[model samples]
Target chain A: MELKKPAMAGTTESSDVMITLRPNPEGGIVIDLKSDVKALFGDAIEKTILEVLKEFQVENALVNVVDKGALDFVIRARMQCAVCRAAEIQFDWGKEDAHGK
Target chain B: MANELMRTSLYAGGTSPVKMIQAGFYNEDCLVYDLEDSVSAGEKDAARFLVYNAVKYQRPAGKYILIRVNGIYSQELDEDLEAAVRAQPDAIRIPKVEYAEEVKRIDEKVTAIEQKAGLPVGGVKFWCNIESYLGVLSAQQIATASPRVVAMALGAEDFTASMSAQRTKPGWEIFYARNAILMACRAAGISAQDAVFSDINDPEGLKKDLEMTRALGFDGKTCVHPRQIDAVNGCFTPSPKEIRNAQRVLEALEEAARNHTGVCVLDGGMVDKPMELRARTTLAKAAAAGIKVGGVK
Candidate 1:
């Protein structure tokens, strides 16, 4: 799905991550991440962000994440929220995507 | 068809893992991860995902985990059910349930999810929140609507608001509706849970309400805060004296049954069928509450 506007999700609470997304017409994903635990989990956190974006097949967006020791699931949820909001779509896990076929 | 004592079912918002984890560790009989009313519209998706993962991963042991999904009419109901069923909590509580068909439909959706996930069919159960006049009137049908429904909780605040009434400490305003719900659940042979006592700071007020519900034969009470758990559990837990009396009655009844007699005597009083049933129920409640009854090692 194509992005319709800038969108964000998640909270700044402990063990949560706030993700913001903007439409990028460049047709590829760009990520800028900030985390307090960057020294130890930087690469792993970035990997999770990319994997979540790839799962949604989001290829054209500028994704920025501010992490606060969020677990993998929190990151996944926040990113999914950001993508859906930016694309102006509902993230109904009930629906089958093209990939489900 | 004995109902378990869910002494406390604590409600926590889906987005707040901090609060949820606190509730889980508090040893309430059940922990309700709420996505309805508690989460803002924009954050529903995030809350669903968070609650799903929490149920799947961080579920506190020894507590029944339940998720309160959005109401049947909400646009988010399908996805909430989709996420909740996959996570596989003990049950999904349906808010604002007014019709029996609503439960049947959600049951169908849960069944489909179970099939798709290869879990046991009918593994998840439902707890209907009866909040409106229509719901209270049809409570019996809603209670017996599906075998999957194990409990019915009254949403008193919303119910009073619907009737254009206000809450009082003595609870006279809601006495009839409350009793009606209790009768409906009792008739259907399911658990009846009392509504929350919103004033968390007033232990005396909560105790008064709990006493009323207990006297009315409610199985438990829903809690909005962790501190309320101890008080709720206390009201439901059988005292040692109560347990001992129950044990004595059972023992006397056993002796009479051995002799094939129609009547029994305990403490110079007749021990009949109704008394025996009450005694048995008391012991069952004690056991369910994890209390050490006499002669039970």
Candidate 2:
């Protein structure tokens, strides 16, 4: 699904990551991440974001993540929520895990 | 969870992750992580994720963990059940269960999920909240619908609303529904739970309500706030005097049994078959509550 409008999810609290997704005319994905542990896990976080976007088959979007020491599951859950809201899609249980496939 | 002294099933809103995590330390028999009614529409997805992660990682030891999913007719029910079953809580409480098929459908879904996840087939249980007039009418059928059903609780607020009656402190409004649910549970041999006493500040009122429900044969009650846990747990636990009386009756029954006599006298009364059963049940309740009984170790 493609982004209908800008949508966001998650909180800025510790062990969480706020994810915001916006439409992009460029027709390719771009990721911007800010994290305290960026120096140690920046590449890993960026890679996971791209991987999730690819899995959702979104070719164009601007993904913004502000991290507060969140684990991968929190990041994944937040990303799924943001994607679902942006695309105006239901989180189909048959096709997704508890945190979304 | 088997309702052994499941006195206070304290509800912790899924939005408050810290409180949910800290619930087990409060000594409440059951900690209910609530994702329905307590969570707003916008935050439903987030709360589901949070509750799932909490149940998977931070669930406390020695406390029964139950998750309250949304109603069967709600759009969020599927996601809620998916999360709850995958989280593997002790039980998943289905809200506003008005028919037997609701429990059967959820039971099938849970069993499928358990199989896919490689968990034991019947490891997860179900708790049905009979929250409407139809639910009360169909309580017996619902209780007997699934072997996974461990307890059935009355939801007085909605039920009273459905009946077009106002809630009163004396509980005359929900008295019949309460009794009906108790009778259904008794017939099905499952635990019966009472609804929450919403007046959090009124300890005396809570005590009165709890006493009434306990006397009516409810195994436990729901609590919205942690402060109410003391009264809920205490009311369900047998008192010292009651425990002593139960012990004396058991002793008399034992003596009678040894002498091949079916009748025995205790405390200036005749202890017969019914009295013997009551005493046994009392001792069991005391033991479940971790109370010490004289002459019964």
For all candidates in order, the CA lDDT equals 0.84, 0.84
DockQ each? 0.38, 0.26
Writing each residue's lDDT as its tens digit, candidate 2 over B61-170 gives 77888999988989888778877888889899889999999899889988888777666898888889999999999999999999999899999999999999999988
lDDT of 1 by residue, B1-297 (tens): 212458789899998756766676786888889999899987788898889878776777788889999989889998898889888788899999988988988889888878876679888889999998889888989999899999999998988888898887888888888898899888888888998899989999998888898899898889888889999998888888888888999888778888998878999999888888888788888889877666632
Best by TM-score: 1
Task: Compute the interface RMSD for each candidate structure.
Answer: 3.2, 3.4
Instruction: Name the lDDT of candidate 2.
Output: 0.84
Model 1 segments more than 4 A misplaced: A1-4, A23-30, A92-101, B1-5, B116-118, B259-261, B294-297
Each candidate's number of clashing pairs is 0, 0
Docking category of candidate 1: acceptable
